[model samples]
Target chain A: AQSVAQPEDQVNVAEGNPLTVKCTYSVSGNPYLFWYVQYPNRGLQFLLKYITGDNLVKGSYGFEAEFNKSQTSFHLKKPSALVSDSALYFCAVTPGTYKYIFGTGTRLKVLA
Target chain B: DAGVTQSPTHLIKTRGQHVTLRCSPISGHKSVSWYQQVLGQGPQFIFQYYEKEERGRGNFPDRFSARQFPNYSSELNVNALLLGDSALYLCASSASRQAFSYEQYFGPGTRLTVT
Candidate 1:
């Protein structure tokens, strides 16, 4: 079985400061990782994904994630945070299949 | 192109009642999947259908069932709904061969409330 974990229930950061949302995974085979963001009363928006190659995957809205195989982690990051960037972040993983196991989300609050 | 679209954006039902949620996938897509997102929780995979065939199912019980039409549109049906079933039901669609990935495009979701 494959699973994902977002250790922090919530994260707070100041505007213009860098932000990081942590994620880890457990899979029997090579993993495909993804990050999604959800705002108030909306569905998820894909941020980035780590399928293979290029440990640093850049995605929509000035966000990026590093795929660390050894650490079994794929952490979403932004160089600078914006108030609009505040949303719920989710980490999902699939083990060479269509079954996606998602983390229990981490709410991000970017204080203006 | 339009993203995945779900109908009855908001629905209210009571326990013991059955409900149906619908989804229309993006054009040119052949796969659709259903997920349940409870408040303060990540989306949970429920079902996946391709080419109008059921492909995969999650840990959900038999009361939860779904099907995909020829056009790749899908419907999820829940029998004997419980309060625990109250959540945002999301539908996602992906191309048959997205190549090296199963990237899914999500719908705005149908918010189902069981009172």
Candidate 2:
């Protein structure tokens, strides 16, 4: 039963400020993590993924995530947030099972 | 190349009725997956089809079924729909079944509302 947990339901940050969205996972084997962003009335867009090797993975839209194996966490971060960055963020974990378990999702609100 | 596409961007159905959602995978993509996303919740896996065959199924009931055509297009059929079934139906496509780690291109999704 591999699962992902996104503790926050919503995160508010001012524009130009650094932002972080927390994510943690539980899996039996090696975990392949991913981050996706969904805009209003649009499909999900892939941001980044962590399969192996690097613990710090960079993604699109200046997003990056750190995969902590011992802590079972992969947190999404950005150096500076923008108003356009407001969207729904989802963290997912795949254990090479061809199926992904997604977190509940965290709504990011970037104020200008 | 165009990304994944879904037909009928919006659909409304009544209780106990049946609805079919269609999805066209990206060009050259061989794997298609279906998901149900309720308002304010993350997408839930429904089914996965590859090479015109069923590769995986979620915990959904038998009332929900799906199939993939030779062209890599797929359809999800739900019978006796309930209000709880009202959600956005999402379709995602990948190059291969083994390429699970790769990013999946998602369609705009079909908003299904069960009254």
Candidate 3:
């Protein structure tokens, strides 16, 4: 079965510091990984997706993800964090099943 | 262009009751997908329809069903609802004709609460 794992339930980082939300996926075929952010009471907003391109994929709101095939990881990273960047983040993988399997989610807290 | 849209921002129901949720895809989008997002969890795939035909379905029970209209609008119907069914229902749309696999645009989602 294809699945994704978000190791951290919550991540705490001071504003202006780098932030990382870790994710690892398991898939039989090529992994179609993506990142999404969700604010309270709001729907998910797509951040970035790693289809078949450069390992480092840049996305909205100054976000980027590194797709590591060896580690089976697609970690979301930001050079500098902001208070507004604090939200729930999810990692998903779309495999051959034509369905998406999402991670449990990581709550990113950017302290100001 | 307008993004995907869903109706009934919030709803409250009880066990054994039936509920219907609606979604309108973006103009020119022929594919629509439904997801269930419980609190503190990720969204789970429910169904996907293209050109008003079912393309894929998740592991959800028969109590959860959906259909797409000729206009590309879709409806999700859940019967004999349980507290477990309480969650935010999200609708996503994509242009399937161009690429079979592409990122989907999501809507604000409908929050459902069961008592």
Candidate 4:
């Protein structure tokens, strides 16, 4: 079965500092990876995805993720973090199927 | 353009009762999927419909059911709801089911609380 793992339960970073949310996956064949952010009482908003080419994929809200094939990882990163960027982050993987396997999620707290 | 829309932003029900949740996919979107998001957990896939047909279903029980209309709108029905059913229900839509890398647009979600 395909699965996604987000090792960190929460990550704390200072404002204006670089941040990384780690994600790893186990899936057969090629993997379609995605990152989504969720605010309190709000549905998830798409951040970025790795479909085909381009190991580094840029997305909305100044977020980007790098797809590392050898490491089997797709880590979300931002050059500088903002207090408003604090939220729940989820990593999902799809095997070109209708269902998406999601990780437990990691809470990112950007300290100001 | 409007994003995916779900009706009744919040709902409260008791165990053994039935609840119906509605969702309308984005304009021209042909696929709709439902997910259950428990507090502090990532969303779990419930069902997926395309062209008014069931495309996929998750590991949920038979009490959980859903359908897609000709206009691509959808409704999720849970019979004999249990307290465990309390969670946020999310609806997502995509251009088509055939697109392997299709991105899904999500609605604000309906918060369901079962007592």
A best-first ranking of the candidates according to their TM-score comes to 2, 4, 1, 3
> A22-109 in candidate 3: lDDT tens per residue?
9999998888888999998888888999889799999999999999999999999999999999999999998755588889999999
Predicted structure with the largest DockQ when compared to the true one: 2
Docking class of predicted structure 2: high
Docking class of 4: medium
Compared with the true structure, model 1 gives a TM-score of: 0.97
Candidate 4: where are CA atoms >4 Å away?
none
Of 2 and 4, which scores higher on lDDT? 2
Q: Model 1 chain B — which ten-residue stretch has the worst lDDT?
A: B96-105
| Cα lDDT tens digits for candidate 4, A1-112 | 6789999999999999999999999999999999999988787888988999999999998999999999999999999999999999999999888998889999999999
Please state the Cα-based DockQ of model 2 relative to the true two-chain complex: 0.80
Worst 10 residues of 4 chain A by lDDT: A39-48
Residues B19-74 of candidate 4 have per-residue lDDT tens digits of 99999999999999999999878899999999999999999999999999889999
Model 1 spans with C-alpha error above 4 angstroms:
B97-100
**TM-score for the B chain of model 2:** 0.97
TM-scores of the models, in the order given: 0.97, 0.98, 0.96, 0.97
> In candidate 1, what are the lDDT values of residues B1-115, reduced to their tens digit?
8889999999999999999999999999999989999988889999888888877888999999999888889999999999999999999998874312767888999999999
For model 1, the docking class works out as medium
